[model samples]
Target: MGRVLFVTPPLTGHVNPAVGVAAALTARGHQVAWAGRPEIIRRLAGDGADVFPCAVPRRLPERDASLKGPAAFRFLWEEFLIPLAEAMAPGVRAAIGRFRPQVVVADQQAIAGGLVADGLGLPWITSATTSAELVDRLAGTPKVAAWLDELLDGLRSRIDGGPADPRMSPHGVLAFTTRELLGPATVPHQVRLVGPSIGGRAPTCDFPWDRLDPAVPTVFVTLGTTNADAAGDFLRAAARGLSRIDGIRTVIADPGRAVGPMGDTVLVVPHVPQMAVLARVDAVVCHGGYNTVCESLWHGVPLVVAPIRDDQPIVAGQVVDAGAGVRLRFGRAKPDRIAAAVTRVLDDPGYRSAAEKVGASFRAAGGAAAAADHLEALLSG
Candidate 1:
């Protein structure tokens, strides 16, 4: 039996997909463990999970809409991603020594895991949580791209423990998104598009399932777990939008207390059993987080995507381009405009059909189990 080590960032979206794949590996009689912040890993992976502690930098609230294009990319890599890699490398190396895994599965965002594993002469796979790598927009800007390349080189120079390794591993890469939704692209031969690795997510909140009315169509609205502060006004606008509609109910996951005073038409809660809600909802209104969009589309639910920052605009564009949803301006979207968009998606069968088509692709792409098969194959070879 092969022992697989999952090195991930502390963020929930990055860690969740690996959880599913890890579960599949465990079921196949392989030993599985994680290296990241203990609190996050434990909460998602369970208390009994073999977790190697890694120090994570405290991320301050970031909702800077002013930082655009190359500047945003630089800020993300320099301020967050690179720092995370450097902080995690020591722990990753230590875990490699102790856990003695056959392979390392590093999240696409957790660059240190791949770098350190390369240093240790171990085979590692890139666990891409999103499809952005296949079609990165930064490739268009020569100066910015060259600067970013130099930045990565500098990171590797300072932190490189051994021979050079591509930031994305050449051995194998597990992409959780299917090409059907992301469209045609130049994907490496080693990269496997294994759909969304949505395993049994341990529910954080006990949802009021009884509160949901079957008579009315419901829209599940969320900004995911991370963007509470940035999405406050938008969430409030969505709540108001849904509230004004007749014979429709909306469930808003208000983790940051963003929405105030909900009526019978709107249910405001700190956390929701998102999978459960997704199963029952007619449509989704969310910031274009890849996980939420994919999960929603996986359930054949259409979306009204309001992009905020980072890869969200790209994700929103994908949603619109795929005809699976409507895209709205985050800061500029008024309650009336949100309501109209939601109405359009709900009323139009075309959007629903498009969402179902994407959902079918996701289902056929063979999620976690297929990902496990791919990983196991890499080890065998």
Candidate 2:
């Protein structure tokens, strides 16, 4: 059995996918060590994987805090990536000195892991929960992307002790999304499409899924755990859109600060087992994150994607093109538009039909087990 070191970012979205990969490795009798923030350590420990805390420069920001999207991205780039890489440079050296491993698997957020692997002359592989070129593609938008790129380049220079090189893409990048959504032209040979790595959680929730009224179409709205503040706007739009539809019920997940004021047809809950809710719901209105998108597809539920930040827009576009859903711009999103999109998805059978096909293909791709097998092959070779 080969000893492997896995490093992930502090965010739940980034860390969740890695948990499944680590668990799969452990189940295969390989020794796995995790380097991440405390929360990630706790999560990995809960899954029976050994944990090693790798302190990032700044803790993840509160879910509801208000900051301009660009500014927030800049803050993450500077505080977390730059300083974290500098700090980890030494820690990684020390860790290599102590527990030497054959290979390192790193999430895209933990670029330091790549640097450490490079420094130690070990093989490095990058695992991404979202699209790999998401930031670079978004940077094509005139001043906004340019400004962000400049900031990131500066950070890279500081971390690497010199100017940033344009050839610095991750050594081997693995994306969870499929080729259909990402398009053949967009993905390069270096990036491997491994399908979605949605961990090994059984559908064991005891929620009353059968109780949901079938006569009235159900719409599931979720913004995930980290970004509940964005839910308020989405929920308000959803309530306005679905309020007029007869017998329609909307269930929201993580309605935290957005709970108090809701439409009569909407049910507000702090958390709902997403897969359970999706099993009963006809359509999903979401922020287009990879986990939620994959979950919605895995359940064969069509999507109404309203992407706010990061790679959401790209995912939203993929959904729209694949006939699985429609994409709505967050800034231009309105109640009528949301309602119309939801209605289109629920009323038309084509969307759900297409979604089911994608879901089946995803299932056939072998979920977590296939990913683990791929990792093992890489290690053995």
Each model's TM-score, in the order given?
A: 0.96, 0.84
Model 2 clash count equals 0
List, residue by residue over 1-381, the lDDT tens digit for candidate 2.
Answer: 988787776677777777677778888898877776755556434645555666655554443334546666666566566666665555555555566777778777777777667655677677778853533555356787677567656655555522322224345666676765565445655666677777644332345455468787789888776676666766766766777677788876654656554656677667676766777889998888888898889889999998877667778888888889988877667888888888889889999998887787677776566667767877898
How much does candidate 2 score in TM-score? Answer: 0.84
User: Which ranges in model 1 have alpha carbons more than 4 Å from their true place?
Assistant: 58-65, 162-167
Highest-lDDT candidate? 1
Q: Report the CA-based lDDT of candidate 1 relative to the real structure.
A: 0.86
Q: Which candidate is the best by TM-score?
A: 1
Model 2 residue 200 CA deviation (Å) reads 2.3
lDDT of 2 at 83: 66
User: Positional deviation of 215 in candidate 1, in angstroms?
Assistant: 2.0
Q: Rate the local accuracy (lDDT) of all candidates.
A: 0.86, 0.70
Clashing pairs in 1: 176-195
lDDT at position 342, candidate 1:
96
